[model samples]
Structures are given as C-alpha cells and as structure tokens.
Target: MSTTRRLRPGVPVASAPPPGARPVQPGLDELGTPLQDVTFVVVDLETTGGRAGEDAITEIGAVKVRGGEVLGEFQTLVDPGGPVPPYIQVLTGITTSMLVGAPTIAEVLPSFLEFARDSVLVAHNAPFDVGFLRAAAARLERPWPGFQVVDTVRLARRVVPRDEAPNHKLGTLAALFGAQVTPNHRALSDARATVDVLHALLGRLAPWGITHLEDLASATDPVPGDVRRRRTLADGLPDAPGVYLFRGPGDEVLYVGVSTTSLRRRVRSYFTSAEKRGRMTEMVRIAERVDPVVCATPLEARVRELRLIAEHAPRYNRRSRAPERMPWVRLTDEPFPRLSVVRDVRAGTAHIGPFASRAVAQQAVDALHATFPVRQCTGRLPVVPAPGASACVLAEVGRCGAPCVGGQDAAAYRPVADAVRSAMSGDPQDVVRTHAARIRTLVVQERFEEAAGVRDRLTAYVRGAARAQRHATAARCRELVAARRTDDGGWELVLVRHGRLAGTAVVDRATDPRPAVASLRAGGEHVPAPVAPATAAHPEETDLLLAWLEQPGVRLVELDGEWSSPVRSAQAVRDAAAAVAVALVAPPAPLVDDTPPASAPERRHTA
Candidate 1:
C-alpha cells in the first residue's frame, strides 16, 4: 500500500518529504469547485461496426449526473436505415427486428443533444462513441455540437494500476471498481457502468486537486517517466501569479518565466509534450528542482522575472537578460553639455532612452542635433579656455556655439543647452517638425537619399520620445490604486508605486476591498522621484503598467499624484513628424524684384 496520505482541499501539502518517499502535491487547477456543481453526461453507443464511416449507430444511452445523483436519463434505439449485420446481433444481442420500429438517427439526435447540453460527455472509450455521433450528424446535414468528452478508459489507466485492474477495458474496470451496473454489451448497462468508473477515478484524483471540468478533461495525458519522478518538486506551490525557475544539476538555473494566473500550471506545462520547443524539452529533461517566488501582482512577477534573468544570465532565457547592456541617451552634466550614448545612467541628468540598441539611441541624438545648435564636442571645457584650443567642424559650420574654442561664453551657450533639454524632455514634436521641414526642402530639391536618412532619424526620435514620456509618467507617481471587474465575478485590484507594481488582489464583489487596499498602501514600497539607473532596471514594467492603466473598465481608486502623459500616441506623433518633414523639404518660392511695375494692376471687381 502507498504510504502517502490524501491531500485535503484548501490545505497545503508538506514542502519536504521523508527519505526514500515521493512528495504529494496538489493539482495544477487552483480554482476550487465543489464536485456537486459539475454536470456530467455518461454516454454509450452500440453500432453496426467499429468504423464510423462504414457503419451506423444502433442504440444510444446516457445518464446525466451531479454529485453521484442522477438528474436524468436518455435511452433510444436508432435505425440504421439498413439491415443490421448478423455479427453485430450476436455481439450486442440487438437484432434487426428490434430496431425496426426505432426512430431514425436524424429524428433522435436533436433530443439527445439537448439532454447533454452544458454537461461534460463521458464514455468508456469516448472516441468510438463520439466518432459515430459526428458521422450521423454529417449524414443528417446538420452541424455537430462539439462537446468536451472524457474517456473512462484513459482515466482508469492514470488512476488504477495495471496489475490491480488487469486492463483498462470496460468489463475489467467496472469489476475492479465494483461499479453499480455490470457491462453486458448493451448501451444503457455499459453507460451506467462507465458512470461508476468515472466517479471512482475522480475520487482517486481528488488528492491531486482535479475537481474542475477543465482539469478532468485534460488529466488523461500520461506523465512521462522522467517528469513523473520529479513531480514532488512542485509540492506546496501556491496557485498565484508569480515567477518560477527551473534548476538543473549543480543548481544551475535553466529557465525563468512568469505566470499571470497559476504558477503551478505554467511550470508543470513545461514537462508536458505540449511544449514543442526542443531546447525547452531538453531543459526539462535535465531539471532537478523547481523554485517559485510568488508576487502580489502579475506586473510584479514580470518585473521580478526580468531582474532574475539579468542576475542569472541563464542560457535558456532569450530576452531581457542583459539589462545592463541596454543603451541610453544621456545629456552630460558639463559646461556645454552634449548628448552622448552611454551604457550607464547617472543621477540628476536629463536622459531620453533605454533604447533597444546603442545605434537607435544615436539615431535620435543625430536627428535632434541636425535641427538644434547643440554642442557635438566630446571635450569638457572650463570657464577660461586654454590658449590654442582646437574646434570641431560642427562649431566652424555654425552647428555649435564653439564653446571648446571659447568663441561663445557659457552665458550665451545656456539657451542652446536648454533647447536640447526641453526638446528631449516633453513634446519632441517641435524638433520633429523642424527636421521634417528640412526633409521636405531636400525632397523638393529631389535629394531622395538625404531625405530617406532624415526620415529614419525622425522615426527613431518619435518612438524613443513616446517611450520616454510613458516612463516619466510612471516615475512621477508615488502611489496609485486601480480596480477592474473581471469576467469571473471578481474585482482585480492593482497597486503601483512610482513605476513598479506593489501589490494586487482579487476579491468578490460582495466583499469590501478597502481594507486590502489600505493594507497594501501602508506596507507598499515607496520609490523616490525618477532618477537615472534606479528607474532603468525594468523598463518593461513601465510599459506593462501603462497598458493596464489604459485598458477599459479600469478605475482609479487612489492616487498620490496626477497621472498624465504629455506625449501623444506614437502613430499620431509619427504622422505629425512626417508632415513637418514634407513642409521643410519643399522648394522656397522665387524672390520678387523690389521694383514695382510701371502701370498699376487692374481690378476685376468694381464697387
């Protein structure tokens, strides 16, 4: 006999196990449902032959049940519209004469479908019965109402041992489970026996937390030997939104992920064949343990997953594992500040990006430089310039104030620095429009290649500016609480601080959520005003929170500061920027001569 005790509903299993024993874990389905709330329709079919296309159904029997109580029963004989083969008569004891007065498949199907509505279909061998019904529907020129079918045979294989049950065949399972009715090769008797088998299998799965209809339907897939042995690694895992890691030999991290709903289900899914990625499959094969960290909200989980990936640099993680390498556009805090692409963001500096790459950040910088006379020199000059100081070509062409050569004093260069900072700070449309006008002038001159380069630079600037606006909006908030009604009759509450997710909770509509929100606020982490690297750890967190804030049905409950975005939608900004480029590149009108015409022009309309 197995030494493991049955898992109680709502109680967590032990995290550690005794030596030489496997740990018992709950099922991946976290949504608890009382078995009484589930409806099942046990069905059995007797047909002319095994092949659905070549044969016809002779009889159909079904029992609708809830919590072992029979709600209703359906039994009928179907006429094949042809003679029943002699062999079918011998096997089922159903003859051609017996079905002579039976209703045709078309006549009986509608009523049978109605009886099974809103119930999970159950059969000993589901495919055999379901296949014939589909065939019958095709012949009747009617659409089949696809039903969620459960096979008792497959369930038996999972729940009962082969040695104990002999085999998963109907008669063997019925006898093994001591079913209320014996399988006698008749539709009603076979269906009644399968119903008892289903109940027995469900009881066996109760410890695994398989109580819901969805879990029941999907539980039949056999767990591979290697994965089954490590099932204990999931013991005591909470069914909440969180991050999980798969560790291999020597405790090396193999993979990282976040689950918005149930972490258990998401982690367990990796070991199943449904994961088609070959690298992931190999990772699972070598996995030694599963470590999970639960978060109050999915947003927090996402942020944590990214941080963990950056920390570990696991081989299997494909994205966001190198947060340190993402490029940023930083304005150096020097006398005659110039835009520079840097890997690190410092405090008290105006910065524009955590662009996807350094090249993209440079493109934005280049575009802004083309329109504004910002310094392009890399030198750090003092108030008193040294004699014979060299000047870059940008200063010679009037593209810069020549601060390096002391041609322009710091007082005169302040406006240029302020313009660059303002253009980068809020509403970059001014810069875009100016550059767009330049591009239009070039286009009017038929400078196609030059126009293309300017267009690309404009595109990059708009995208980076939109992202920076969102980041700034999130960074400005000290605390925010919002709620939305979920489809499952519950309210989802999310708390955000600065930009990161602080907490989340789902509560029924009848319950007051004020206390939870208050507690979250009292215990939530406070983020200081937006600075450089501190705000750059998880850029995606800002994106996710922004998306959630914009979703329909979301209502703001509390706020420490006003949440607003100065930047418009990326597409709108891009269009406006492009329009500006068109105007700039247009040809200038010819200058008119100062000399007036000898005779005054005549007016067509007389007063």
Candidate 2:
C-alpha cells in the first residue's frame, strides 16, 4: 500500500515582488555560489526525463538558508514546450498537465538566482541536479556564477558513520532527521526535505569539532564505509525499476546498472561482481555514493540503462557502456566486387546491413555468396606477392574474373560484380542474378541445356538463402527476449540450436558483451544468491550468434579469442551429432570362432 499528499512547507518563503519579478544576485565559490555565509540553497528539478542534459526541466525547487536556519524558499513547475516522459512524470509527480501553464526555467531562474545570492549551493546528488541547472544556464549564456557547493550526503557519511548507512539515500537520512517523506516524489517536497536533513546533519557535526564552514568545504567523498552499520539496500529502496550509478570518493563514477529488484541489492551485487575480483575491486577505498533513479517499470529501467551506459561510460560497465559501431557486410560496387569492411555512407557498396557484429554479417555473406557468385575478384583486394602470377587458380576454377591477368575490365564487369556485392549486403533478391546471366549467355550461344540447369540451380539457391535469412532474422529478435545467466559456476555454454558451420558464439557474458567465450580470468562461479533466478540473455552473446547465423548478410562484434563458432548447415550438424551418440552407445561385437559346425563344442550338450 502507498499514500501521497502535499507537504506543508517547513519554512515559509520570503515575500517577493510578483510573478516574473527580478532581484539582486551575487556569486563566488566555484559552483557559481557565494562563499560568505554558511547558507545553502538545496535544489531539485523535475523534468522530461532522467537524462539531465537531453531532457528539459518541468519543475524546480530551491530551499534558501543562512546560519543553518531557513530564510527563503522557491518552487515552480515550468512548461518545457513538450510533454513530460511518462516515466519522469511518475517519479516526480509533475506531469505535463501540471506544467502546462507554469513558467519555464528562463522565466523562473532569474528570480531564483536573486534569491540565492550569497549562499552555498547544496543537493543530495549535486552533480546530477546541478548538471541540469548548469546546462540550462549555459543555454542562456549565463556563467554558473561559481557558487561554493556543499553536499549534505558527504556530511552524513562523515558524521553519522555506520555500516547500516552505506547507501546513505535521502529517504533513510530524512527519517534519521525526524523528517518524514510521503511516497510520491515531488520537487519542492524533496528539496525541502534535503534542506532539513542538512541542518540535522550539521547539528551532529558540531560535536566532532567540525563546526567551522571551511572544514566542511574541504571534505570530499569516497569516505570510509561504516560497514558495521549493516543496512540492506533492497529493503531500503522501492521495488520500482530504474538505473543506478556508483560513485567513489570526490564523486568519481565507478559503475552503472539497471535493476528490477531493490536498488540496494542490485548495487550490492556489484561489490561482488566477477570482474570486481579483477579490476573493479581496486575501487574498495574509493566509492562514496550510490545514486539511483526509481522508475515505474522494468521497461523504463532498460531504456535508461542503455542511455546512461552510453552517456556516462562508467568504468565498471564496459560491456554495457562500450560504444556500439553498427556492423555491416560491405560489398563494393566494382567490376569484380569483393567483400570489405566499411561504415557510414558510401556510393560504392552495393549491400550493407547495420548489425552489431561481423559474425552475423558473415553469416549473411556465406549464405548469399553461394547463391550469387557473380563477383570473381575486385580491384581493392590486397594484391598477392606475385607480380606476374597471371590468372591464379581462382580464375581457372571460374571463381575469379581473371582481372589480374587482364581478362576483364572494371566497366565490362560492373553489373554482375555489383549484384554480388548487393547480395552480401543483405539483399533478398540475391539468387536472381544467377538465372539472369545464364539466360543471357544461353540466348547468345543457343545452349538451352546449360541454361535450364542454371535456372533450376538459381531457383534452389534463392529459396535456400531466403529460408536461412528468415530464420537468422528471427533468431536476432529472439536475442532480445533470450534468457541469460551471468553468475554461472563454469563456462557459460550458449546452446546454438541452429547448429552452424564455423559455429560462432552467440553470447558473451562478462563486463564486455562479445562472442561466447571462456574467461580464465574469472576464477570460480559467480552464481547469484538464490533469491532471484537467472534470466535476461547477454547482448554480446546474442549479437555474436546473430552475426554467424546471418553471415554474408549480417555480422557480430569480435570476441576475445577464437569463439565457439558455428557449424554451418543444420542437417550436417545433426548427422554428425547422431554419429557421435551411436558410437558412444554401441556395445562391443561378439567374437566368432572358425571351426567346422559338426566338430565344434560338443561338450555343451552335457548340460
């Protein structure tokens, strides 16, 4: 069960001139705030989304204080010129309906800045909230005004030290300060509560001979954990799904994750990640914060996770955060076309697919090439050492157009070569080229018998390529919903049901999603606690499998080593498997005796 209600302001706001009224402003300490008073303006903003820079703000809340007593307060919901994302609205309780008539940041910031004059800026997670303010301020060409900033989150960990407080979330600290927060998160309400917690925390800090303002300013994060405090993150956070960020001392980002479980537990697993034993654990003395965004559903979490991983590029999330270069199977538009690596727009490539892996691209290529062997060779192909090798065996076998031996010219060979390139680039009409050329050659030579054979072969090839491409494409989609297990006790075997030749790995389970691989680096099992079962397939593995199965048409990103590549055709794989099973099951044959039937073994009759 949950409840929602408006919180009566704890401190009344100072009277101001009317709406859109302006006031005097001053600034000093780094983050665009003055250094004079012990005052702090704790801020929180509700916007179109959690992506601070890309998403615009719909609401802003700033609490003004001096000498640890509230002096003024500001709150406003701004019209962002767009509807708020459903997920953001759910988190902040500030929907588009609520912000339709509200003023925008430009209209509100001028007044807020005047009210914030000569005060230290504050926020629970200063980097994120302030980041939005700075970006918005930048659009107006206003310098952040270099205000000295202080984080109450940093203070609580230093003064209230305990293992139970490892996470130090706003909600937990709010309760600790005798300030209660209702369920639905609203901008002004949360900002006010953060201000209250800072005051409460400052009161406690006084006893540790830490009363001086300068002493607090010099403090940084990655503070030592009060491990003995013993707090559980799952029990602390709502079950809502969202993205999480791990910050070490001084607010250096360590990792990021998406979760449908307790934010605390999801983050806690990172403390025990298989990679942690390698490089991640080196962060033991550094992490001072765990920031999270609780969304309404798992779908939002997934979307946010992908976005954050790309934007932040956290150190520990390499597999999720690495840059994605959509792979494509390139077929050059040359006289004797050849396969080549390419990205972006180019006039020459006849075919290319935007895949995540080369293997998938290769899979598409392999299937298409057999059907459309139109390109025998190309100009760009690396020249072998033979300067006068004359046509190699490929030209002899009819696989090459003999361009090296001067048998063909780029202009004359352009069309068929272009067809081959297009076929490998994921075109479905690949097998048609074979029949077209055979028909034309037959018409010129009057060779009806060979033309008929070519037609039949072309038909079979097209049908086969289409069928294989259909399956490969479906497998790619299945990867989106495929099951995954990261905490396996042994080599994470990804079963390739399609059984391909050059059997490429379809799953990579480590911090980097690559082809299916064996990591001697991860020493034992990384089995998760029994509370949650294994699910959600690794993208790296699925991407790799897709590349191999769809090769010549699609491809996958490379793996760490020689992966468990595919076995090509499914029928051939099944036959081989059956043979192995039979060999294992068959019993030893009986021994035969070479003796005349009438004279042999008469002693047995006595029995």
Candidate 3:
C-alpha cells in the first residue's frame, strides 16, 4: 500500500520569505480536544548532516491532514550549496548533481511554512525535524511562526510498551502500524508513513481521555487500563479545596496531595496523560480509588495535607510531612545553658533554626560556641563538680567556662546565657565582632590557617543570626499581607500570621484589588491562632512561609505588626570586622621618608 500523492510535477515545492515577517502565536486548540477537530502536518527532512547549523537541508516533505484525510502535500529539493558527505549521498540517494539547479533553503522554507500553516507540526523525533526547519528559517532571516509540535515518537512510547514495539524508531512504528507507505529515509515517503503512525497513535489516546490538542503536546504517559477503570472514583469528589489520597490494593495509600484548585479536577487529571511523572504513573496504575477530604479554603487544604502526610507517611509523598524530623538550634534550658542541635524543639527552650540539614544546624551551634564560653559537653550536668569528672579540651582552652566543674555556677553563668539567647533571637553584634577581632589578631600573627577558620565561623554565625532574625520577625508578626506578581497578569496575596500562611488569594488586573485584599485580610483573621511557644506550631508551615518571603521580588503589601530585621545586627558587625581584618593583613604600603635629603637647589644663568 502506497500513501504517496505526487503533487504537480516539477513545481517549486518551497516558498521564499515574505516581504514582511512577524512571529505568530503557536496554533494550538484547547485541551481535551477531539482529534477530528485538530489538523496535523507530518513533516520530514533529508539533510547533509545531523546538526542544524553545520548541515544543510537537501529536501523537505510534509503531509497536512485532519481526521485521516490528506488536506495537501508539500515536497521540495534544495541545493545545499555545500558538498554532501559521501556517507549521506549513499544513504539518501540524493547526489550533488541531482540538486544542481534546485532552489536553496531560503527558497524552500517559506513555501514549506505556508503549507504547514495553522496545523500542529508532527515528526517522528520532533526535535530533529523541527530543529532543522527552524535553523533553516533562521539562517535565511525568515520569521518562524511558533507552531505547536507533536512528536509521534513520544506518542508511540506512551501508547505502545517497549516490549511490543521493539523500539520507537519511525520505520519500526510504520511497519508495526502497517502504514500505507514505507519510510525509505526519503523525506516525502517517510512523512507519509509518519502520518499513518500518527493516526495510529491518536487512536490510542481516546481510551486515555486525550481528546484535545493541549493534552496531546503535554502528554508523555498513557493512563494504564487499570487506572482508567478507576476514573469514575473521582466523580464524587467535590470541586473544592482539599487533600486527596490515591489508595491502592488493600486500602493502602499510594499518594497524598493537596490541591489549591478544584480537588476533583486535579484528582481527575491523574487518570489522563497530564501527569507524566514515572512514580505518579506507577502509583496511578495500582490506585484502586481516590479519596478526597475537602477543606474550607486552600490554606486549610494545605495545612490538612501536611498533617495527613505526617500522620500517614504515604509512600509517594516526599516533603512537608516530616516536620518533626527537621533539626533545630536549641538553647538547652539549664542553669548553665549551652547551644545544641536538637531534632525536636521542646518547651521552655530557646531555639533559632529549623535548618535544612543537621550539618548547618551544627555549624550555627559551633559559631555560638566559638564566640561565647559555653559548655560543649553533652549529658546532664551536675550542679557541683563530680570528683571523677574531667574537663574537656574545649574547657581547658578557655573556649568553655568549665561550668561542669562548678568553676562557674548558675548565677555567675546567667549573663553568658542571657547574651547567647539575645544573640540567637535578635542581634549577634558582640559575637560577630568577637569572631572578627579574633580573625584579625590571628592574621596579624601570621596564623593564616587559624584566621581562615575564624572567618568561616564568623560567616556561619552571621548567616545563622540573619536567618533566626528573619524567622523571629515572621513568627512575631500578628498578621502580614504580602503580594508577589504571578506569571499571569495578577497579584497573589499571602496572608501570614506567626510565620504560617493563614490565607491566600489572587486578584486579577480586571478586579478591584483593594476590595479583595480587604476581604482576604478579614477572612485571614479567623484562622486558628498559633499555639503558645511558637515552636509548638507547625514548623513546616512556618518554614514554607519563610521560604516564600525570602524569595526575591516578593513585596510587603501591609503588615499589622512590625516586620524588620536588626539594622545593626551581627551581619553588619561581620562586615565591619571583615574590612578591618582585610586591612590588618594587607601588605604594608611602600615606605616614604619624611625627612628630605639635605641638598640645595641649583640655579643656572645665561650671559
């Protein structure tokens, strides 16, 4: 069977660039579109070499079709204006002499573009053909109308398992699908076979609920038959904000997720090709049904999601579920208090960080210990020195106050504990200055290695202090209204309280933002007040809000409480100390004698 239709013989099958060229929006219809309503132009190219920049197109072929009917055909040969590599000449059956009088790429691209207009571009490996065409158009200074691209290769990979197809190569697919035309490495012949393969791929989409053009381009996985059978399970889900669970055999939960948009819509999407993640695909395959736990608002949904994940520890859930596992920089509540890295933030203990890693938390603790003579020994400390207790090397080196030995009692050590708590909560100016001064002293003594160590400790201290200050400021805020411009022309309003996002809303340019902002603030006030000892509140939620606030370009729209970092904080002290240290270690300026040589100036006179 042959699908090739020879266009008017010897006609110029390519067009030159139009006089005025402008970019065109990618022509794609809405998602969930019926395949019959979408037009696709299957394209193939024969080039001199693989690279678009280095190679030249020898021929272009395309078949424009809709609903299994060929709308038109385009074919052309071009003089590549360069020698075709010997291997390519034998491989493609197109020789230099055969293209002696053929038009150049500049003449071919415009016509090809015209033929494939208003259709999704389809190719076996879409990138190769599309890339070559785009490169050719760019080289000829022609504007490329960004066309929607669909790869039949990707479609075959999703539709047919690797065991069934052997491989996704165009020829293999053409034969497997029993195409009317065979791909012979010739542009037109290959394109026609690709069209057949495309139709076959489309036929596979209906069962997976891929009826739209938008869905086709983004589709990378086919919904497994078992997963599709459970699609109706999402039917009863309310279109509201909530957490949804995908449960597998034996009622075992496979995944848990929170949706700010329609819970039903988001849950339903998993059954289609929209969700491309490999793990998600596997989870869906085993999922017997979806269970939705609806919430009043998106923020509530998010909070509930975190709670559920922490409770269930679902296999497919990765983050925001293990808040208790995060490390905190805790100041032990003892008479001789010492800074330590603890995973669990307990009551009556002052803490700074819920750092991303324990290493960072330890670094912060080390920074504090370096600046203050705090005890570094672990375990319970006896009020008085025990007869057998031996001092650690740190205490021997004056890094600790030797509180374990009763060298410094609780009353005497209270000031040091107070300074540490103040530094950790607010400014660490004295601590940063102490590290900085030590760094300079070490540099002056030419103890370069020790100086670097001091500098690193100082840097860590300043960073920890800064992060703590930010978190404290956020935690102290009664309410905060912040806005960040979204990708779409709209503003995303974030309502934060005690460092947790209380509520969120989006205001479009078409709406009166002030009213929405006011309404959001009013609703945000009703969120459950944070628990006492702020650390007891969800640190994950607090961390999430902190991350958002820390992102560049987020604007503070309004704040019910003061939101500020210490201007004369440890960070400032570190900068000053760094400058002094750099100057102290700098090479001495070349010496200049203050006393001039005792030489008289001589005058010459002409007679």
Q: lDDT of all the models against the reference?
A: 0.74, 0.51, 0.72
> Which 10 residues in a row give candidate 1 its minimum summed lDDT?
1-10
Model 2 scores a C-alpha lDDT of 0.51
Against the true structure, candidate 3 reaches a TM-score of 0.46
Model 3, runs deviating above 4 Å = 1-244, 250-252, 258-282, 290-308, 343-349, 356-360, 379-390, 410-415, 428-466, 483-491, 507-518, 525-537, 547-558, 568-607
What lDDT tens digits, residue by residue, belong to model 3 across residues 1-607?
1144432111111133587887455444432445677778999999998998888899988888776677888888889998765335535667677799999988878778878788889999999999998888888788989898998877776777755866789889888878889897789999999888887787776566566676675566556687777678789898888899888898987789989878999988877777655567777778888889987556557777877887888888766567767777878987678778877656565777666678877877877887778787777686887887777888778877788877788888888888888877655656655665675566546565566556556665666565555566666677788787766777778888777766788777677677878898888745444322243246666656777776888887777766664444543443433433333444322112224354522221111
Question: Which tens-of-lDDT digit does each residue in 1-607 have in candidate 2?
Answer: 1122333333222234698777656344423221224667888777776676688888788877665456677887888988765334324545567787788888987877777777778988787788888888988788777887787676666656554454578888887667755313667788878877776776665555444566566444322244312234323555556777767776877777778656766666544322223234444435666778886444435545765776777776655453245444455643356665444335434434444455555544544455544443444533332366466676677765666656666665666565664343234333443334444455335454554444444433333333333333332221121223323422222323221111212233344433233332132223222110011222333334444334342222222212221212221222222222222234222112223275442221110
Candidate 1 or 3, higher lDDT? 1
By TM-score, highest first, what's the ranking? 1, 3, 2
Candidate 1 global CA lDDT score: 0.74
The digit string of per-residue lDDT tens for model 1 on 1-607 reads: 1111222122112234668997567566555445657777889999998999989999999988776667878899999888766435535767677899899998999989989998889898889999988888888888888787888877776767644855689998878778778997789889888878888888787688676665765577745678656667666778998999989899999989889899988877776655544456567778888899998667668878887888898888778777668788877898778899888767777777778888989999998888789887766788788889888888778788787778889889888888777767654656666665666666555565566667678777777766775676667667789998877777788888777777777788788888878877887666666563235337776778778888999988898875664322332464434344235434332122224354532211111
